[model samples]
Target: MLPPVKKDRVITQLPQCFSPNAALHTKDGFHPQVKAMCQFQRTATVSFNIAKVIVVGDVAVGKTCLISRFCRGAFDKNYKATIGVDFEMEHFEVLGVPFSLQLWDTAGQERFKCIASTYYRGAQAIIVVFDLSSVNSLAHARQWLEDAMKENDPSSVLLFLVGTKKDLSSPDQLSQIEQEAIRLSEEIKAEYWAVSAKSGDGVREFFFRVASLTFEANVLSELERSGSRHVGDIIRITDNTDGHRRRKRTPQCC
Candidate 1:
């Protein structure tokens, strides 16, 4: 049976981060500008509320298990390898605005690499998952991210590095791998998280973070294009993605 959407996926307030070191937003809540816009501005008719998120990693690294744990709230013990690609649409309401994330679960097998790579285009965010107990999977995270970035502009996408099967790693071993993982995360500029799908720890928070961040980015981009509202001097919404407008010169403050 499918789980109730509101109980599991609805996000009324801004989701908090698990750690400061690996968090995208170090503060407690959404960006001040985003909050103000949502509070004051009338909701625009958004043609694009759905963000595409692609999940990639080596085989048996718990990518499928990690997603199922959040979307369905149950881990499948009888594991079947993902084929070319599988998808799920998760809905959320961030600060009274409706949002959705299109999760693309790509196969980690070598044979399916070509098929999966084809679907990597137009991704708003990339999640590179690895096993907490496997050091080699951690090493391959960079290559996976490189491959995914080829199809989309790097400046437009968000990156997340996730380590699964946290329960399987011992305290000592986890500490060591996490150090390396953190270093790698820093190098790649991806938010890092450790989760245990079987035990249902950190899975929900991780997805919530992803949804919240993507929603914020999309809204900010919309504001930048709309040009009808003003958040601050740092941001100017002049033209939409398809439209072009000349910026009016203003006197510089001395």
Candidate 2:
């Protein structure tokens, strides 16, 4: 059963409200099977940059749907309450390097707030979504950002304000939505986008920008801790199947 939603979320920032609640005991959709594989196996040429990212927004603004579309390339119209937070792992190769992202999708309902913020703490990037059809949700976008920022390291959290349900946006609804997003983004200093999660619009580029920002963020974070400007590269060599040792290249930022 889901935990009862707390009314004393006195902190306007829901993400901050989540600070007191540790992660739920249940790892509903989290699977780290590959971690063991790497630990047990000797893979000398393995390459990847793994990062944790969390997606957040107000209830019914399509947080779940957007995640479905982005990760699975599909959507579900049926209504099913997210018991807690859900997760997906996506691996992609970009710019001759391999990257993996742990994508977290949190329940947006007011009642599930307790379980939501726990996942925000270590996120390298965040996507804050709002519904184009609802002004109230758009207004709440800042609160989402605040909550996420509270749990995460502010210096490196690459946040983007996405106006979802753009397929429903008409010419009449377009200007006001754009202005509100732009104004709020400036106020909070966030990047804003109009996207149709149903049509997969702006989804790829959204994360592409995030990946680029996070890659840089990782480098800066390493340098700051080590007091060194240069992040190194990882070059591993191993004996091949039928031949001599082979070399593998991976970016070792910081």
Flag regions of model 2 displaced more than 4 Å: 1-46, 227-254
State how far residue 180 of model 2 sits from its true place (Å). Answer: 0.6
lDDT of 1 at 8: 59
Q: At residue 142, give the lDDT of candidate 2.
A: 86
The local distance difference test score of each candidate is: 0.80, 0.61
Global CA lDDT computed for model 1: 0.80
Worst 10 residues of 1 by lDDT: 244-253
Residue 46, model 2: Cα distance from true site in angstroms: 4.5
lDDT of 1 at 50: 67
TM per candidate comes to 0.84, 0.70
Q: Per-residue CA lDDT of candidate 2, range 135-238, in tens?
A: 99998998888888988777667767778888898978977887888778766756677777789887655555555445445544544566622223221122
Looking at model 1, residue 98 earns an lDDT score of: 52
